[model samples]
Target: MEPEYWDKNPFKATAKAFPPGFHYRPTTLNKTRKFYEFILVDTNSVSIKHFKDPKDPNLNTHSTIQILKVMQPRHYGSNLNQPKKFSAPFDPTRYTYWDYIDAWTNVFWHQNNKYKHSWLIYFKNNTTYNFPNWFLQWWNYFGPIPQIYPEEVQQGFNQFSRMFNNQESRIPADLMYFSSFALSWIFSWQYRYGKIENKFDNSKAALDQVKNWFQVHPEFLKPADPETSLFLNKKSQLAIFLAGSKSKEILAKNLKEVLHLLQQQEEEEKPSKKKVESSDENDDQDDDPFYQNEDDCFGISLEED
Candidate 1:
């Protein structure tokens, strides 16, 4: 049977559309999201082709991996009144927030280069509502940052350090602590909900990093005065808890054993009143000197027989 078509044009073929003997893999930084780079490999010939979009004309089809260098920034207007904008300017500072996003979109969809395709798409699509204001302000304040793997983590730590060091930043210590805790929670959630690989390790590592930071910077753990020591102590306790061992299986087993012991104790504490009542109803009743009223009925008489 012939393949289906619409408007006499073939349907957009994703990585799954490729036939046997051709291995198709779409690479993305975020595993939960769509793939940015689509790579098609011919097992028979061992050749490979990489493309952001399969429909693009300038797809990089080669025998080996292609290394697309970062694009160089174009010169701005000499007078600053008019600015020169390239399709994908290498420097993000040259353009406004929205303009930079537009340029990045162009790079992802139009140009063929080594810029992180997945991240660009993520930032562009995710920040559409905020557009250039909040994003631009943050960018300008923090400057340019690389969105790649280890560098991303390093950049985040550097930013955190900058905020921590700035006395004028006015960011609360508890806020910072909670922010790190929230990140750890997010990583844990991802691992539990989506079962994303390495997420558990990442979450553990993040908690450890936060714990180390607090340990090293004892000042942050201290209160401004002795009056606030209680609050500070509570915060410290929470920090320790977050960084502590998270063995759920062991915890569950311990909880089960405790519950079982409690149940057994409850059963033991429940006296066999029926057996005592049946054995010596008259003798026990008559001996009970304190059992004068109905409220004092203990079934065992306290009077001398």
Candidate 2:
């Protein structure tokens, strides 16, 4: 079936295809969409709280991203496989998202590309308003499946984010994923965001002004603001607190831990990527060098613009 424009974007998450985040007709995308996809979910589906500091009076000091947390039943994946140490391992093959659905969902869902493919169809049956646990089960309890290549996921996601920025609505997670899928198509096949070909030998457009395009475009809002979410009530703000200050120290400590884990995932994914390039005969291999490199076409130094 021909996909609708409002559905998937070339750069959307899981653009090319993800081998069903939730498998089985019962659990996979056939049933749930939200938990695998969106942020600021139905409040009841997942519990959310702003980090509080009883030690200090300022309960309101956190990065715009700090307030997110997803809740789940305690016993979901503890019986057989343990949850991977990292909450959101970029290498999904090594990690299971289900150990704690909300935690994992927030990591993937918070970004725009959650469930990038599902939006392509009119999914009236299986759905999720928030993140899904069944998707996480494989990573958490059964041990990792063949992980999706991070380079590919990254490319799909960046394009997904760009496409989500292009949308005018609250950006449900699935839609965020789809828009980038659409954009990824543009990045690879179309050159222009549709079917038209690129006239230049290499169609590299500078990314320095890409965010500027977001600034101008209503559909794509800065990840920083309330404008981007139906959920994040507290608007995004820039703050430079004293480095030695107690509150700043705590936030820094927690965020640093999260970033460190993400760093390790980055490293592991990095090594596999080199092998992917050098090898010539793998059957499951992908076509583009990787989605991330495309950013060079769009990416100017963040310092510049």
Candidate 3:
């Protein structure tokens, strides 16, 4: 044997090398469910792309990556009267709760608690797409969402709402907290579950969807920075505990004011922080989303959505 270099837990060395808990837990549970849900239509999305090009050895790998980035599903109306979000140019094409509902019903298999096997659906479907073996399981890039319970959903909604109650301002960019990372699923679920699930008109329901979510709690709009640890105010936290309706636009307008204010504060303090986090701060993007990315398919506009 080579020099006996050992520790109490052989696994512990690798685990400790990363942040605490980084390597210790299962992280795939959420994204798998979401993707499976995305492909639930009569003709699944992933099913259409199976191919192998004779010219390029890497064609499969290239195509596989492209498909995964298509993680956000786009649907169109056939005859359902309801159109899918981002579908082909139509009289109207925006995501509605009904389409979402139909998709999730089959995707989740929530009927029998044991349909939990649907969790494997993503892997199967991706393989079903018959992508190059290389990129198929290359790495797990997105996950750990939708495991949200109704309670946490309510809490996130409440946290955001309370921050805007009666205020007129911008909100902290980080007010969404994990939402910046999780909104692809959470915001959709929270609003849909909170407002439109009832027998309500489309426009009215959309407005209410935003409103009712912010109505209960407000802490959700404050900015969070690693340098400054600000706690959610007690009164604000209390309202989350209470049950009450709120107005989203009013709260949102207020929250936006707070965000603007915070943005101002950050600008004012930037001179000093420039000396500190200059190495850590990420490049800010204040312009259009179609900013160039040489790495992606050149013509697919980032602003398409």
- lDDT-superior candidate, 2 or 3: 2
lDDT of 1 by residue, 137-195 (tens): 43332222223223334444544454353353244433343234322111111111111
Report the poorest 10 consecutive residues by lDDT, candidate 1.
Answer: 119-128
Q: Could you say which candidate leads in lDDT?
A: 2
Give model 2's clash tally: 42
The 0-to-1 C-alpha lDDT of every candidate, in the order given, reads 0.34, 0.35, 0.35
lDDT of prediction 2: 0.35
Tell me each candidate's TM-score: 0.23, 0.16, 0.19
Assess the local accuracy of residue 103 in candidate 2 as a C-alpha lDDT between 0 and 100: 35
What is candidate 3's lDDT per residue for 181-200, written digit by digit as tens? 22222111111211212222
Question: Residue 207 in candidate 1 has what lDDT?
Answer: 36
